[model samples]
Structures are given as C-alpha cells and as structure tokens.
Target: MSSTAEEKTVMKVAEEEVINESRRNFLKSMAFLSAVFAFSGILGIVRALGPIQMKIPEWPRIKVANIKDLKEKEPIIFNYPLENTPNILVKLGKRVTNGVGPDEDIVAYSQICQHLGCMVRFMPAGSSSEFPDRNLFYCPCHAGFYDADDGAKILAGPPLYPLPPVKLEYDSSTGDIYAVGMGPPVIFGKGPPGSTEVWRDLVGGKLVGGG
Candidate 1:
C-alpha cells in the first residue's frame, strides 16, 4: 500500500477510537448522576415521612398513707393505679434511692413477684435467713427475694427482672405520702419479661378512685 493511503487510514481509526472513548465517559457520567438523584429522592421520602408519635397515658396521683403514721421498717399495704395490683409503702428508717419524706427513708414498690404472678411479703432487715442484713421482699411461692432498701433489686431466684418500684411523692405540709407512678422493668406478666415499658402497668387493671 502507498505510504500516504496508509497514513490516512491510521488517522481515521484514531479519530473513531477517541469518539468512542468520549461516548463511554459521557454514559458513565449520566449513570452516576442518575444514581445520585435516585438516592436523594429516597432520602427526601424518608424525611417527608417524619418521626413516630407515642402518646403516653397520664399517671394517676393517689394518696397511699401518712409518713408520720408509719413506723420504722413497717409496711403499709395498698392498691395503686391498678385496683388489682397491690403495693407496699414503708419507712426504711434510713435514706435510700427514690425514697421520699424528710428522712428520705420512705419508699414503695409493687408486691407482684418478677418470677411469677405471686404476691411478695415485706421483710425488714434481719427478717430473711438468706438476706438478713437487708430489708427485702420475699416471694413465698418461688423464693425470689428483692432488696427493699435498694430499688427492689433481684438478689436471687428465677426472677429475670427487678421488682418495679413505686414512684413516691411526699406532702411535707400534711405529712402525706402519695403513689404517683411506677419505675422501669414493667410489672410481672404486664409486658415482655424484663421489659422497661412501665406504661403497661396502668393497663390490665383499673385506676384507684383518687389521690
């Protein structure tokens, strides 16, 4: 072949190769822009959906006892927001967590056992052979013990969760003690085992008449 003709053919092939390369780059750019747009659209949709709303039920304020009337290490039995649910209000005689009143020794907790649907009895310090040094709640059915001075902590037995403590409020002017709310880990059989959904305690039973 003539040199001039061969040179012309090489130039044509190089021009076509460059044009093909430019087309591939353009397609790649378009694909990337389309993916970005799709991702942004998904994000916008999620934002438009907003967040979930949960309306918690109002806690009832029910008067349980008089702090002055309570004796040291003694328990006052009463039904709280739930008419069927029994609880214990006590003067531990020493300050503790979530305790109320002038001494900060007055506290309360649900009597329901965390292991099973059994009632627990209040045991003053030295009352139990297993845990004599601590004021505790002893479940007669399964022998589950809860620390009374503490936040009803599970000491031993099959109970998977801590006993739900009653949220107490004290009236200094009248020396009155009120049952206001409940703590976490829910109530026995009220929700999932060891759940923190305390709102479930309000359900499955009727609220007491008044504060």
Candidate 2:
C-alpha cells in the first residue's frame, strides 16, 4: 500500500472514532437529564401528598352567659378559645319569654360562617317591634343564611351546608352554660360526601335539617 493511502485510511478511522465518542457523550447527557427530571417529578408528588399542618388553638371552655340572660327568639354573641374566636348562643322558644331552665327551648351555635369564615348575626322576623316572630342567622359577607332552631341548617345563600352547631349542656345545678363539643364545620360549594373543598370555607359537607 502507498504511504499516502495509509495516512488517509488512518485519518478516516480517527474521524469515525471521534464521531462515535461524541454520540456516546450526547447519549450520556440525555440519560442524566432524564434521570434528574424523573427524580424531581417524584419529589413534587411527595410534597403534594404530605400532611397539612393547621395552627388551630386548643379548645377552651367558654362561659357563654347566665342561663337566664337569653330570651326566646333572641341570640347572644360571645368569644371562645380566644377573644378573636366568635360564637353565638341562641334561645329558641315557642313564644318570646325570659328565664333559662332545663327546657328544650335553649340552644347555642357557633357564629362563624361555614363558608369563608365570616361572622354570622341573628336576623329577626316579625310584624311586632318588641319581639321577633322568628329567628334566623344571616351571614352578611356571602349571603349565607341558617335556621336558628334545632341545628343551624343552611336556609339559603352560597353556602352548601349549615353552620356548625356547638354541643351545649347547661348544668341545672350551677346554672352555668358549658360547651361540651363542637359540630363538624360547614362545607360550601360541594355536594354530599367525598369531594374536597377549602377548610376555611367549610366543614364536613354534611347538611343536617333543622327541627
């Protein structure tokens, strides 16, 4: 073989080897990038699945008022857990009357609007100015309304569920009002069972009818 031909052959072999090396490096880079992206995707999913920590204050026993203070069809507003936490105590009777004793007429509920955490107020209904014919709860912020008697049922408005009713037990002996437990939070914008919504907006999403 001629020397010049040999040189040309060697050069051709070297060029092919360089091309092969470049291809291998590119493939390695692609593999590394793919692995990094896959790992990042898994981490993102883990973060999404992690538990959300809420900073709700410990439940405290709220002294609503003297049992005798509330009148029929009238409501009282108070705070619990902290001064900032608002609650509503209502006295329901067949007719407007005073004095609280062991009777089915006295009831209390939390005033915090189940939808978006707005404050709720008692709305009076009647032709007479002295006493309201009927009592209802109204949330001015989002027009959420709840029935006063029995459980606070969602009467009308954007709220999908009723206000959360706080469990009340009055000590007949002491005449001190005590809150035993709290009902599940009201959930808005969702139907019955399993669909998720914002916690601050609503509770368990179960709608219980008023008595």
- Top-lDDT structure, candidate number: 1
TM-score top scorer: 1
Q: Report the C-alpha displacement of residue 144, candidate 1, in angstroms.
A: 0.8
Candidate 2 Cα errors over 4 Å, as ranges = 1-58, 94-101, 124-134, 186-211
TM-score of each: 0.72, 0.56
**Clashing residue pairs, backbone N/CA/C < 3 A, model 2:** 185-203, 186-203, 187-203
> How far is 142's C-alpha from truth in model 2 (Å)?
4.1
Provide the overall lDDT of each model, using Cα atoms, as 2-decimal numbers.
0.85, 0.64
In model 2, how large is the Cα lDDT of residue 136? 76
TM-score of 1: 0.72
Please give the TM-score that candidate 2 achieves against the real structure.
0.56
Candidate 2 C-alpha lDDT tens digits along 43-131: 99989999777653334455576777777667777654334456777766642222234775666666778777788888766622433
lDDT of 2 at 161: 63
